[model samples]
Target: MLSQLQKKLLNDFQQDFPLSPAPYADIAKTLGVSEQEVLSALQELKQLDFISRIGPVFPPNSLGNSMLVAMSVPEEQLQTVAEIINQFQEVNHNYHRENRFNLWFVLIGNNQNHLHAVISEIESETGFPAMRLPMIANYFINLGFELDWND
Candidate 1:
């Protein structure tokens, strides 16, 4: 169950995240809570997987390139493969799926070449071929949710 504070924190400030000297503190004041309270709630939300991350959402084509890459991994080797994939700073998101390309991740870079290099490195380092699925078109959506989870 989501706490009132957690729900508020997730829905109220999805976008226009604080870009000030003390962003979390700013949110604390706005939410009538202490800085530590806001920080704690945010941390809890992340730990609970209610949110992937609380960070900047860069404009597509502005921060180089990104792709939805996936690779097949034997069940016994999934953890090891995931660990190697997570080592790259370019990897913003990684997850396990129930498909042949079971280990999935999103890779971001400053350019197409840089993006490919990261992919190449992952393949070389992990010895698993990654299928790159770059976006041909994107329809922007409000990723934020307005939940009615009774607290």
Candidate 2:
């Protein structure tokens, strides 16, 4: 069960989380709790699987160059390929989808050259040529949820 503090955190802090060096301390001050309390509660929430993670959701192409890559990976090798692809810092999300191309992922890098290099590395490492599907546009659904704690 989520405490009221956790509920407020889920609802209110989805976006606009502190960008300061001491971000947790900033959150604590705003939430009227000690920094440690905020940290502990967040840790507990993670432990309980209430939240997958707490971090910034960068806008596409805003922070750096990125691409949506698809690969025709054999089903038996999907797990291995995903592990290798995920080893790169550039790869953030890798998913298995049903299609001729089973494996898909997103890679981000400091620049366009770096992004292409990462893709090349992934293709070399997997021995499967990947199709580059760079984003021409982005669409997002606001994901914040409000917990009705009164009930």
Most accurate candidate by lDDT: 1
- Per-candidate count of clashing residue pairs (backbone under 3 Å): 1, 0
Candidate 1 local lDDT, 1-151, one digit each (tens): 7778888888888778978999999999998999999988889989989888888877776757888898999999999989989999999999999998899899888888888988999999999998999999889876666767654
lDDT by residue for model 2 over 104-127, one digit each (tens)?
898888888888988998889989
TM-score of every prediction relative to native: 0.66, 0.69
- Candidate models: Cα lDDT each: 0.88, 0.87
Q: Report the number of backbone clashes for model 1.
A: 1
By TM-score, how accurate is candidate 2? Answer: 0.69
lDDT of 1: 0.88
